[model samples]
Target chain A: MKRLTRMQIPYRVWMFLFIVIPTLILFVLALTNMNLYQIGAFDLTLDHFAIFSKNEIGIAFWNSFFYSSITTLICFLIGYPVAYYLSTLPNKTRKILVSLMIVPLWSNMLLRIVAWEKVFTADSYFTDLTGISLNLIGTQTAVVIGLVAMYLPFMIFPIFSVLEKMDRSLHEASKDLGATDFQTFVRVTFPLSSSGVISGVIMTMLPAMTSFVLPARLGLGTISLIGNVIESKFMKEVLGSSGMSINEGAVLSLFIMVLSVAAFMMITRVDKEGETLI
Target chain B: MKKRLWKTRAWKALGIVLMSITFLFLYTPIIVILTLSVNSSKRAYSFEQFTLQWYVDVFRDPSITGPIVNTISIAILSTIISTIVGTLFAIGIHSLQKKSRIRMMILNNVPVVNPDIVTGISLMIIFSLLSFTLGFTTVLFAHIFFSIPYVILNVMPRLKRLDPNMYEAALDLGCSRYEAMLKVILPNISTGIIAGGLMAFTMSIDDFVITYFTSGNEYMNVSTWLYAVLGRGQSFTPAAYAYNAMIFAITIAIILFINLKKEKKGKLA
Candidate 1:
């Protein structure tokens, strides 16, 4: 075992350099006045904290929470029944159905966003094929639709896996003890599957909350989440603009990171091995 | 009792209906892309006619081919490196005491859970901090950095299932430690390794965010390239649709082929 442990030293170094060091840099940049352009001399200041005072920041936060909550709620509504249905199928059918569900994921996500963008625009292929021009571009509804399409699988898989692994006799016992079907689900099945539900919510909500591209494309530049704010800030830095510095981006990133790390902790508590993460 | 049974059947029917709707939601955009790929229309906004010219154009167009080559190469390179390195790391982590192993597992899950924007920014800061040139090498490193965790995630469960005494048994039967590992352990965990490798490949290929930030000005993968042209109004090619459609087709083909092979093998056994 000791000899085997030696193999991880290289990986540890890799993680230290990549993960640990970068995280520390993110914290340092977020806390200080260090600019990406002027990396030499800088003093610690709470100046970046002023970003939170901006209207865009406030709206970004609201939009992030609003969109993510709606998306997660919708996914749970749609996904829970889908997962339960899949769980009831025979083994071979379930396997085939689940794989088919996952196949869309193997395709490029950006392209799917682009596809949705095309559909939302007036005079789209959808209109051409079905004579129904949605013209839904630049709307929150379009963004949410794209999000649900993108992340529905993330919700369904966790719940389905947990439900499948559950002891069926529990449900049988609940029914035998004079429980109604809905009562059995409410009291026994749903409670037992809470961990999977948590995993699913975290998985769906985190991505929806922090997503940049999905909103950028599907929202048609009308919507702004915390992700877009962070992206534009970094883009400004990359494009050689000192205004809206990378420190501001770092602060925003750290803020988002805090939320994500909390969610990750919740997942770790429920799923010790992260079996449902994929 | 009859009324309760009727309600149960109604619920089941509703489930099937919702499943059908969800499946349509998932597949509609894909079907759109597939349709637009063969459409004779130059504009993706509206379909003009059905034709295979865009598929032909995908081959002739330099813009599409260049990014496709970059995406594939980076995906292949990162997948190979991450798969091998991550398998070893999983073995090493699995060798640890339970307390430390859980800590390591949590640490490994960081990249998995962190939003891509943050990961991208953090890596960008690190590369800039170290003064490493941000290009293909930096992008490859970034991919591998994020990818190894997934590989570890996939392989760890397989490692937990392996019999710990098998290695010792192999050693006692005249195999060297390295030989024991190669002959005994790696073979047992080959499926996980392959699955992890496949997963790493898929992630690397589809990645846009991290690659966007890390690739700098000189390089662009398919995703970043699509993004760059997305705002350019008319220069965006329908060939992109063709390209995505082709990749979708190939993936479905590969999966179907693999399933057929597996079923044939199962029948043979």
Candidate 2:
């Protein structure tokens, strides 16, 4: 074992301050009733957990869950085939296709969501040019479309990379067993790609469930996701005099944190060693 | 057998069709935005001519330009900071025992896997708890915080592949620890370091949620700015589209040029 060097100390401090302490603070804040003004007389309570029972918050949770799962399902339906096809392509073309998928992922996502929002907006260029109206801007459908577009690349990359690295002999052996192509895919390809599917679900689902921008923009501020709820709780003057207090926001934020952590654990459990990650 | 062959061919044709449609779906937004940026038509739907007027407007507009400058500076500064800190942390953790290393790695994944919203609010909580005003400093700190994981992920793999003897060999030859690191170890991880830095830079620039939470009311990166105006119904000008179009064009050209150059070198080699 190497001796601990002095070089590790500063980063340890940095980590302690930035990473470790902030997480501890999250838990502490969640359990305690401390706000900006209530520095003293701190008492632990789970009452804020009851905030989830509030009709609006509960609806937002369900809305986020519904939209995110549907988005994940749609991304899989679209991405799985794209991933499989790309994996079978010649190496050069496969490389190009993979890079093209990643290209959009790098662009500023806010701009993309805004651009997508226009498709459903009144006086939209799509409607104006095609003589057809989407008229869905303020609807949940618009928000779902925006989420899918924003996260589509995330779904594709995970599945494609997993498929790319998968041993081809499995498929070939299945074919030698007198199975049809669709049978070979269903029995062998799909089962083997389950880890990728799982990872893609985690990748797409978490972001979708917690997405604030899409619902804010495409929903035209009419719809709220779990993320929007959290944002408003903190960002709005919802503390001290007239706003919802801090501890309640922490409870919601902690709910999201637990949801993602569970997803991460499920992912790690499936691929225990992080092999499925792109 | 003959029927199976025909079916396979049919499937291939279907595959091509599916691929084309998917490509169109993926490419439409960028193409549309780029076109809209240059479209000279008076209406949102009209594109009777092409002009660079929006690009000019984007450059001249103080509100947009301020966010642009802020975004670039924050991105660059956070990238540099994260690169240095993350690379150092990666080295430290690499030297640790296996159990601690794995534990540290999982802890590292927390921010990566945590939804940005949760991370944003938690940090926001800490800042307000400490009575630190949410502003540029808080946003930059948040960016650096979230960015370190990317750098560590990139660097860790390279560190594991490092030749243990190189540093020791240099040390045995009378080089000090720092000198050995500088001469022997640094070069090995340079590629990983640069890649990590670039990823961090992009993540910083593309970030909105965390910045939205931590930037308070004063600072607005291009993302937060666009998102703010976007919520106000068509508060976005075509100029915003022009800014991103220029970015997309530059990114594509650079990537293509690099790919082509690599291909040519492969042929020559």
Candidate 2 achieves a global lDDT of: 0.79
Model 2: runs farther than 4 Å from truth?
A1-12, A129-132, A173-188, A237-243, A272-278, B10-14, B41-45
The candidate maximizing lDDT is: 1
TM-score of each: 0.97, 0.91
Worst 10 residues of 1 chain B by lDDT: B229-238
Q: Write the per-residue lDDT of candidate 1 for residues B1-269, one digit (tens) a residue.
A: 89988998998897898799789879988988888788787765567788888888788989788998999999999999999999999999899888888888888888888888888988998899888889999999999989999999889989989999988899889999899889999999988998899889989999988999899877999898988887565446788888888878877886787778878999999
Docking class of 1: medium
Runs of candidate 1 exceeding 4 Å displacement: A237-244
lDDT of 1 by residue, A104-197 (tens): 8877887888778778888767888778788788898999999998999989998998999999999999999999888999999999898899
Query: For model 2, what is the error of residue A249's alpha carbon versus the real structure, in angstroms, after optimal superposition?
Result: 1.2
lDDT of 2 by residue, A1-278 (tens): 17434445576676677656767777776787765445777788887787878999988998998999899998888788778888889989888877787677667787677567667766677665545567888887878777777787778777887888889999889989998788988999888888888888888999899888788778877888888887777776474464335667777877787788788888767664354554
Candidate 2 displacement at residue B28 in angstroms: 2.5
> CA lDDT, every prediction?
0.87, 0.79
True contacts kept of each: 0.64, 0.43
